[model samples]
Target: MEGDFIKINEWLKPLSWLYGCIIGFRNFLFDVGVLKSRAFDIPVISVGNITVGGTGKTPHVEYLIRLLKDRFNVAVLSRGYKRRTKGYIVADANTIMTDIGDEPFQMKQKFPKVTVAVDAKRVHGIETLMDSDKKIDVILLDDAFQHRYVKPGINILLVDYHRLIIYDKLLPAGRLREPLSGKNRADIVIITKCPDALRPMEFRVVTKAMDLFPYQDLFFTKLAYDDLKHLYNGSTRELNSIGSDEHVLLLTGIASPRQLREDLKPYVKNLTPLRFPDHHEFNDDDVQLINETFANMPSPKIVITTEKDAVRINDTKGLSKEIKDNIYSLPVKIKFLLEQEEVFNEKIISYVRKNSRNSILAKTKDDDKSKDSHNSGNGSRTISF
Candidate 1:
């Protein structure tokens, strides 16, 4: 994980060193089964980041769901970050963001047919999902890279191009939740939030910079901003529909809104950002501020927020009809760069299809014949962290 990484928070180096030591020791416990990591017979795919903040995990998980939902009964398990209720709870029609995390709620709202459940204990969550009436062929673990309790069949690690883990330090200093060495756990690595017009040479430089193990397939993805949908009614509005003369009040309560702001810059030149901490629960004061800030804007102005933030805002009552009318959720999805979608999809599909309990090969195939250190495919290699 060596590169020309920009170092920040140099003053907190001592604390970060201590945090890294603790995290490394904890990981060691799971590494040797002292903590007892559980592996499911059903193909489990984990979409997570080494950093504490968002690395586009939600969009990528949704991508996998879209890819495999038709071919397999897909289930999503999340820790339900900041959820009021605890212990495994299955998402139903009545499920809200409070029941599941906003990210999971977004997924459930986007793909209602797919089963969604949340529990801090991922092992318990997967077991419950398996025993439920739903015939789950595969399970996707959302934000579980540090969650060693549930071993996934395919572990995908996402890195933000804007804030590469290589450029980051341990928590309380930088965004990384674990040591950079933790990257070795990844079976697939994705550098996300790439420029839409990234050159081939840039890709080569990044791929070489990553210097990933041969067993781990590398992919690049950029956020494909879609049409803005109304917060309440789900009415679609094209991003281009917002005229150049129009003002946009960007309300975001995500881990990193920098990239989102950058993306919106070309289309909406005049954007006022009302930022909030990640997973910030909305209150009446926040709502009032949003209304006031947005109302204070000139004519031909609108309020736009992320889909995750929109879910929370939708649940927050007392929004004036004016704010409701103008507030829209900008939906974003990951589009693999360099046309690597086919390769990535084939890898994901093949792993699940071969490892699925219902598959005859799953019963007959020898575990020793499986490929890679992950045993997810035809080739296996080991790399020192």
Candidate 2:
């Protein structure tokens, strides 16, 4: 399947070239001020990738939420890809996946205190957020690398270690939304899904390949898989508990399931993957098919899916009780590699502290003292590097 995809992409090189030209022209227009970009008074940090699919954007956004929620009122803004709704919608307790899209819904679920809102027009969205009663101090823009209309204070560009932009072509022929030169706009460049054991020499090679500007801070991060949690209930099980005698049916609607599959291989006796398009909304037929597939498998079998897919799956009506009982979701978190956690955390904190709209609050002696304490590792949310 992967080889076929590569061949198809190779055959579409001409289309890719055309697409690249169009994207480049659009970017040039933005750069030359032919197209106006709006900048907000408050800090707006964007976490995005050049590629069309997942490069671990959600986890990194969640990381930022964890880092800033205690110090400031953080709000996340996304375009809400594939949402049924049409306009700006702020996620609340009653909001569903269909209302605000899967990723935003998931983030809202994880961080109820932090605001999560979606709108196609980001400038309008930022305005709406600013006008809201909630005292929002900062905004995190998810998957907005190509959103040139809103100028983010800190633009973070994520690059998948396995699928570097240096080795990729434009869309249709490759996953990139724009040319590799687009990376120059980023303030920080992160290499995501890297191996924990990656050596300094390997990092240097990747750095050389990226050819990042001196102003751009490069970092590496790996996904840390947590124990499996039941989809319907709050019960948990160790990842290794699914022994070699058990049959595993992996269901995924994400762009890349290779890492999840590899993680589950050592524990399960037989692994079968049911793949779907990214952000796929589950339907009655899909649930029925899952049931049929699960029923045919041998005893001691179970179904597993990603945390993102689990959000949509749990929302599917008419899902069988048996399937619901057997299903589990694997959670993942971002772990910065080579003890760079402090560096990343300091950079983010410094940005927010510097750009906050409350100039008096940011410049006060008390605020400076508090920041000094935080720097000295005495704060409530001290990130260890």
Candidate 3:
């Protein structure tokens, strides 16, 4: 079966090449100005990847939100993949997963203070946010690296360390959405899901392989898993609390679960994973299957899933009470490796501070103050920088 799969992929290379040409042409049009790319006055930072599946985009966006929310009114805009709603829709307390997609809803639930909106047309989405009453200082575009129509102030590209674009191919044959040359478009390139203790030589090798421009900044980040939390209630448990004798039914719908599976191995006696496609919408039949699987498991067993999957599973109806009670979501965060935290923070902060409209407005206010002092018959006070 494995050999046959390889043969099939080999046969599909021609189609992948054809797909590559069409994508390459579209990018070329945008690159040379044949296709118009809109630019927003406010600082717009985009987080995305060339690959089709998860490369820790959502977590990194969340990291940015945490980094900037205290100082600026941050807003997030996404395409709301697989959402039922057609046009632009701003998330509210009443919004459901079906309204703005699961990821947006999950973000809203986690950070109620931040504004989250979804629109297929990102330009329209930005316009709507600008027209709204919310005082948005910065906009973070999620999963929009290839969305060249709206040019962002800072373009961040995420590449999975295990599935680097250098070793990947175009769609139908592999997971990449565009050619590896697309990496040139990114202003900041982050190698995501890196091992915790990456050696200096390994880092140098990856950096040399990427061959980034002098202007592009490179950073490495790894996922930091937190203690398990109950899906419904707000209870937490240590990993070792699961006991060495307990069995675990690992349930997930994300694109990559291998790392997560390995992380849970030492804690559980045995793991039985029920993997699903990325962004899978759970149905009644799926719920029934989960219930049966849980029932068949031995005593002291529990169901564990990624934080992203928890959003959809929690929304799914007809889940048995027993299943709901035992399910938990493992929280994860992006941690910059090799003590690059300060450098990463400085770069992001400097970009936003330099491009933000608020910065210009503040400068104008300072100028007005100087003029007012001059007009009031007082010598203009010298402002020390």
Candidate 4:
């Protein structure tokens, strides 16, 4: 089956090549300044992936939020993929999952005080966010790796450890949205979902294989799944509460759940996965199927899902009372491996501090807000606020 899958994708290599050429040309236009890329006065840090599907982008974004929210006025801007409405909209008390997309809404719910907004045009999003009276110290561009209209101060790229870009092919033939060369644009490259027990020799081997530029910094992180929380009531309980004889129905909508599945296995007697597509919306059929699946399981069975999926499920109507009472969300976060979290955090904080409108750089300049240096010919500018 694996060989057959490979053969099928190999046959589609021609299409991938055509797609790559178009993407490469677009990138070239941006590089040459024919297509304008704007820079904001305040610090803008983008976190994204060149590959399609889940590389744990949300967890990593949350990690940065946790690191910076205490010291800075942080805001998040996302494109709100597959949202119901159009144009830029800031998440507020009345915002639903469909209004700002699942990930942004999830963040807003998790961090009530943080600002979260969605706009297809990231440049407009950043500008509007800047115009706000609350004074955003920094903005995080979620999943904006491909949206080059705004040149972020720090470009953080995430790669799935299980699906290394070195071994993968371009889109249609593989998961990559662009050529492996696209990895060069990343200021910081992180390998997500890494094994906790990875050896030093294995680490050295991967570092060599990546062949990153001298200026690029590399880091590794693994998913750290937290204790179970009630899907409706927002109450917490330990995973160890599930007895050894109890069953767990691991339901997922994200692209990759292998690591989560593995980590959950030892906690329960039998682990049964009811998988769905990435960001899948639950309908009547799905609801029925889930109820049926859980019914067939033995007694003392409960359902578990990732926090991302839990938000979508939270608003879904017509769920059975029993199912609602039993389902729980497993929160996950990223932790830097090899004791390098402090190093990564310092780099981020340093960049934000240096470029903030209220930073020492701005205070020393003695300007009203910023001293942006605009390039005359290209229409692009570097902001040293």
Candidate 5:
């Protein structure tokens, strides 16, 4: 329930060292093929982070769906973190938050045409998807950077602008799930949650600290909030309409909500925040607390939650059925402010296309060699280089 990132204390230092060594060794084992990686016949584009939560993985995954949906059959796979389910489940219009987890449900609800699947074991999830009726051309693995068992064709790593990996230590010490040197695994590194007025010098400093491998590409992005929506009825609300006299309870279960609180501070009379673990599943106990807290507040008190948490609470019945109607969710989207958006998209598209063509060429050559061997008296196959 701790809201501040600064609260991660000195005790985490030694713990972080131990965690860092474990992460490093695990990754090395994968790289050296001591541990095996599984690949589906379809390509997977993994979007994840080395650091822990709130680097904006959801938005980037959604961004990719928006960018590539028309031309490709993309299937999104996530490890339904706090779901009640035990095995892989495909997300559909009828899929409940309790079944497939909130984010996957939200994705399925948002993009009805796309395929969404969830399992703690992502490789198993991918296998299940391939066996299904859906004609999946490619897969998008959500938050799978540390999952070295599956190799993605293009690995896009997101880093928060405020919480650069360079400043973080592994696990308990700081937010990083892996060491800074693990940046070598990234194909493209995106710095998310950037300030609109960020300076060139600041960007250079981060890049220098990252010390990216020669093959890695990096970009910067920011979150752009659309008009605020009411959590109760999903009604559109103007960001400016809410008066300063309105006291509000901000309920967030995200990794970092500091930016959110700071942005809304000017408009609210008073902001009381309730924090929970990232991707937390609210139970009856949580609902009771929210109920008691809201009942004591004066009139015009509104309950606000993030979009991800909104989906999770939709099934909770502990809060009065009527009170549930009052809750609201703030929806946000990623905005890549680069001047060369088309160029960036083109680079990604071209890389995939080139790789696909090479695979086809190699297959065609193999077929020809097989035919030649069958026709020849020597019965020895020869493939031209």
Candidate 6:
């Protein structure tokens, strides 16, 4: 559950074959159409991973939103993982995490211009989007590679640079939800969270092990942080800018906090890490602990959490108000390697545009052909495309 043990489990080695068999059968069924994947009339691109968690899919989804927002009418559809609501719930300014799920809420907060909706049944969610306000030209499906019920136009699969699928076994033993063979479904494969000091040999080894499709595009990206900011009031402050006189408390609820801790090591004057599970919903009790900890930590203490954690903690009320007031969140964005940002950006944009345009043309041509057939049969009038 921690450290190198995360890499492999001795007891799970035997179960790998069984996991592989189940996954293989599932893929085969889908491939043969014995299991149907429903493709919508609208453009849907899925951003997901083969491995279970912590590949930085959230940032990738955000990257897509930023890349496509200007040119297209975009919307996000997710399962709303731990949400309380059932059926379809679209995230507006009024939508709460309890109602629409935390990730969608976070998406709503970050990209208010775009629509965010969630349904355990993705087809229903897509239907809601199709029937809602705002002209949604495209839909981005978050964490949806496994959700084959509603197929996407483009599948962008992410694999962590350090945790290649080839080196990993299936679940129970390893992190993969499916086998490395499942890479066949991805149109774009990204190796995320790469070190800044990547060399040619390392890149070569990764790319080789990736064993991608002939047409699949591969890219590398890393998590780069911005200045940490206050959680409650949204005031900006640099990580290293923390004065030597300032004592700080770090709070995080994510799959990985080691990276975050290391990032603030040089900058923060004094540090205290309050770790929680990934996507942890902080209650009053947790906030109380933070409050007490900060109160006892001398006079000038600053409380900090990651951006995702900040969003969750922001809603906590009661005695946590003063503690929350001092709570600041550090923001980080995905920075791609190879200076190919524009190239990758254009590739995705161009694909969506090209396919969407093609679909429109095809539909128009079909409509015209149908009209012509009707006219010819009735001996009435002509129709043209």
Q: Tell me which of candidates 4 and 5 scores higher on lDDT.
A: 4
lDDT of 3: 0.89
* Model 6 ranges with Cα > 4 A deviation: 1-8, 244-246, 296-300, 318-322, 357-385
Q: Where's the lowest-lDDT run of ten residues in candidate 6?
A: 376-385
Measured with C-alpha atoms, the lDDT of residue 112 in candidate 3 is 95
After the best TM-score superposition of candidate 3, give how far the Cα of residue 348 lies from its true spot, in angstroms. Answer: 1.2
| Candidate with the greatest TM-score versus the true structure | 3
C-alpha lDDT score of every prediction, in listed order:
0.87, 0.89, 0.89, 0.89, 0.79, 0.81
Which one wins by TM-score: 1 or 5?
A: 1
Per-candidate TM equals 0.90, 0.90, 0.95, 0.93, 0.85, 0.86
The sequence of per-residue lDDT tens digits that candidate 1 reaches over residues 1-385 is 2232334466678899999999999999988878988887889999998987778999999999999999999999999998889899989898878887888888898999999899998988888888875467899999998888888889999999989888777888888899998999999999999988888898888888887888888999999889998887879989988898899999999998888988997889789999999989888898889888888888888889999998888778887788888889999998998889999999999998877877734444443344334666545754321
Question: Which residue pairs does candidate 4 place in steric collision?
Answer: none
Tell me how candidate 1 scores on lDDT: 0.87
Please state every model's RMSD to the true fold in angstroms: 7.5, 6.3, 2.0, 5.9, 5.2, 4.4
TM-score of 3: 0.95
On a 0 to 1 TM-score scale, where does candidate 6 land against the true structure?
0.86
> Per-residue lDDT tens digits of candidate 3, residues 72-136?
88999999999888999989899998899888988999999999999989999998998794478
Off by over 4 Å in 2: 1-10, 359-385
Q: How many clashing pairs does model 2 include?
A: 0
| Per-residue C-alpha lDDT of model 6 across residues 1-385, encoded as one tens digit per residue | 5755855576677788788898899888988999888987778999999887678888899999999899888889988877887888877777777887767888888999998888888888888888774367789999998887878888998987767788887888878898888888898999988877799899898888788879999999988888877765667877767888888888888876665676677787688787889989777787678778878887687888777776677676654555766767777889889897988988888767765644576668877877887877975544433
- Cα lDDT of candidate 4 equals 0.89
Candidate 3 regions with alpha-carbon error over 4 angstroms: 368-385
